[model samples]
Target chain A: MGVIIAKSLNEACVVLAENPATTVLAGGTDLMVQANRGMQSMDSVLDLSRILELKEWTLKDSEIVLGAGISYTDLAEPQIATVVPALAQAARTVGSPQIRNAGTLGGNLATASPAGDTIPVLVAMDAVLQLKSSSGNREVAITDFITGVKSNALQAGEIIQSITMPVFQGPQEFLKVGTRNAMVISVVSLALVTDYLGRKLRVGVGSVSPVPFRATEAEEFISQEFDWEKNSSLSEKVINKFSDMVADSTKPIDDHRGTADYRKHAVGILAKRALERVCANGES
Target chain B: MTSEIYTLTVNGNDYQILDGHPSESLLWVLRERLELSGSKNACEEGECGSCTVLLDGEIVCSCLVLAASAVGREIVTIEGLGSGNEISDVQQAFVDAGAVQCGFCTPGLLVAIDQLLNTNPDPDDLTVREAISGNLCRCTGYGRILEAVRIASNSRTVQNEEEKGK
Candidate 1:
């Protein structure tokens, strides 16, 4: 076994280009666990923690570009929380303080778990991922990046460089159901973002499908029904209908964590609560 | 297969890992190679914080950290908590509060509480609970552990005041 600690992004890319089979280690929260359990073999490893470029974040105008190595603890900081409250809320719910301090945004994106706490928030914000390799860089939407459970569209020698999301001035909420309040994987999660400038509401649902997806039908229904000018609330019937539509969009499965029926039901309830918290003014 | 030698800075001392495999975890290297058994190894995974150690001043599960990745980083295990032969204030508070039962989770809990107090000297109950949520104590049911944190915080406040008087 060999380990190469790359001090910069260029060095890391060169290493990856030379040997595409090298296992990239960032934070190592997920990969090391697999290695400990004999589930993953590391013939060669590329440690990315020393790369200074991946640890930085930039805010340009109305968009925020978070470096791939930004930890969940950093994401929940006041600097990012004010701009992306839902992402901060989701980051705060991931694992525990120890995990959050070590787990990076790029690690979460690379894991591509359907039950990942932060993915739904990223999807709702329509985040674009910057993938870089020795050859060049490419951008992919969050929806197109995650292909299935524990699967992603990352090619060999490619690394998630940064995640870019547009800042919006509206109420945002991230809600999830887990067995325990802390240190538990989400059973079902939902993120709701209100785009006041565009007069559109976005909804992202997770843990109930193969990939975290936007509840487009429910978003469309609520966006059409709710009055954006006055920022009025929706009736109880409308909320319920929107929740049902969100539930109908899922393709859940019965797993050790939860049953398909329970996941669908929980996701709908999460969607409903998220909408009420974000959009419900005083009516319902 | 060739074994590579790497130097790890633990508890202000540099130890050369001559027999460690590249895939070995930091927890394994700490306990097996360096003989720092104070950092308990309960769950090899990150779920149980029994193997918690401060890597570069941030508490993380040593089991989830690759030993090779931690070459140049500073690591503080439970053995490095106190100065000289004296147990730290938090460790003494745990003994005073009877927070140790079976004692598997004590080291991790102490490290977590130490970090919490370092950041926030006087944390509320919710803050304390959230701070130590990663550590799982099957014994004491967390009642004594929480009590230990309170005792540590109070003593630290008194100590701070005394230092200010000087």
Candidate 2:
């Protein structure tokens, strides 16, 4: 195998464009695991960690423009917590501080794992990703970008350059249940965002499906069926019905962490918890 | 593989390696090349905090750190703590509090606590637990480490007060 040392983003892009078969290495958190397990083989490798342009993060037009290479450590700052608590929450739950500092959002997007903790939060926010190649750049929504489990619409030679998400007015939260307290992968994860303006609700359930997905049916019921204009009180029957709907929407497969039924049940519990938190915050 | 010549200022000492591979981890380089055996290599997969080290004043798993990627940076291992040929205050506290069980997890725990107390001296119990949550210990159940951090903080505070009085 050969390695290409890229000192700049442009150089990395050019290298990726030239060697379509080369694997791009950002933080090496994900790639190292694959390589160690003999899950990947490549003719070339392009190291992108030294590219400073891809590591920046800023705000523009009330939207957060996050560089793809911004580590979870960078996003866990107090400023990000104030502006985008959901993202910050998700970032805080990611592995340990060491992994948080080394892992990049682009790597998560590239992996497209159903268990990717931050993707659901990004999806619930209607996040857009900027894809760049030697040719040019184009923006794509996160939902459309991820086609399936471990499958993505990213074309060859294109790298995720940046991601943008709107700053919404309502409350949002990201939750996950892992094996242990720290440095454990999710068993079942959830990202719940409320779009209060249009009376629209967004719910995303991860680790319970092929890819992180929205609970549209339950979302509809919570936003429309409930008579919130008169009273925000919800009965047990209603919550049970919503949980059943969430269970039916997911297509989880039994894996090492949990059974399909267990994951479905956990997702339902997480959805209910998320709804409770959102409603509890509504009063304050 | 193409390699880079890098100089790392580690624990007030400088190391110059000519063939540091970018993907090669710093833990092995520190142990094998430089012969600093303080950090353990248990669970090289980053799950166990046995390879914990201070990189540029932050606790990070040395197994996951690429040696060439840490150029022009500062690193502190377990050996760097305390005075010359003596343990630091925190290390002494750990021993006093019976925090060392099998001692395999001692180096990483010491490094983890060193970074934490150095940054946050008067951390509460919950804060200490959170700070060292990444470090795992098979024996002792972490009751001793908890007591150790608190005791170390209190002793340090008292020592400071005595100096001021004098």
Candidate 3:
């Protein structure tokens, strides 16, 4: 296969415009697996690994703009971990040390796997993706960009440049349940970002739906029931009701990793536990 | 298929391959063209760290790295850890702790431990487990492997203090 090493983001876009069908190789964690399995055959590839501009993150206004090329290893940086703990926690659960070292958050979103560990966290944080092409640039929300399972709204000649999300001020938690402890795909993952000052919370769920989604209805219910100023603890009844709402929102299907019933049950348990942890440890 | 010439530095040696493809995995080039078979091809996928190598001092699965993409980068494979006939401290620890059974997974484990100890000489049990979690060993049950890492870490600490005293 022909591969062009683009040293800069502008060079990458120009090459992409010329070879729109060429595969974009970022970290190659997912694409290389397909190539090794004979699942993908490509005539040309655009290697973005050499582009330095795509590897550095920046803080703009009140949001953190992470370059699409930032690896999971970068997510563990103290600055990123403090601002986006859920994303860091999700990155930690990605694969093993080797996988995290090479895998990029941009690659994870581009793959659009429903079971992607970081997708739920991105959705919870309302992350925005910047897609660049020779023509121009456009921004899309994480939910809209990830159209379906193993699919995204990436246009021809376009590549993900970076992802931006508002800085979260409250406590955030990410929880994933897999068959084994490490190096396993998520059966159901949940991310909770609690805004105690705002008297509300944001919930993002993955693997239990066609796309990772926010538990809006569940969030509305809990926010209404929660007394932001006075209540120090959540009642057992409220936790049960919130968990039930989260389970009810999912539209899961049976697959090799888990059954629909198990996914739903697991999501409920994860939601309850995540909410409890946030309530117990959230900042006032 | 048209072939591409890719140049890379592996284990302190410079190499240029005429038949390396940009899409071909680094694991294939290492095992086939360069004859560095120390990095095993257990799972061509990234799930198994059998093809683990140090890419710019960071551990990454060679199976997931494209040979062309690795051009101008530094890579350290299992065969590059020691000079000539002498083995690295981590490898010696594996032998002393009886960490080898079938020995198929030994090379990857040795590379992983070598990288881990370089960064953290005194890692806890959880750190050791996390370091080698990508590597799967069906024969040793990982008990001796943990012990081997602990032994290597202790030995390195002792050697470092001696050097400092001198």
lDDT of each: 0.91, 0.81, 0.90
- Give per-residue CA lDDT, model 2, range A159-275, as digits (tens): 889999987767788889887767978888888887665677688788888888888888898777654454365777877787788878899999999999898898888878877
lDDT for A98 (candidate 1): 91
True-contact fraction per candidate equals 0.70, 0.21, 0.72
Model 1 misses residue A238 by how many Å? 1.1
Return the clash pairs for model 3, or none: none
Sequence-dependent TM-score of model 3: 0.98
Give candidate 1 misplaced runs (Cα > 4 Å). Answer: A280-284
iRMSD values, candidates in order:
1.4, 3.4, 1.8
Q: Which scores higher on DockQ, 1 or 3?
A: 1
Candidate with best DockQ: 1
After superposition, the stretches of candidate 2 with alpha carbons farther than 4 Å from their true spots are A1-7, A37-45, A226-231, B2-5, B18-22, B160-166
Per-prediction TM-score: 0.98, 0.92, 0.98
Return the lDDT, model 2, position B163. 94
In CAPRI terms, model 3 is classed as medium
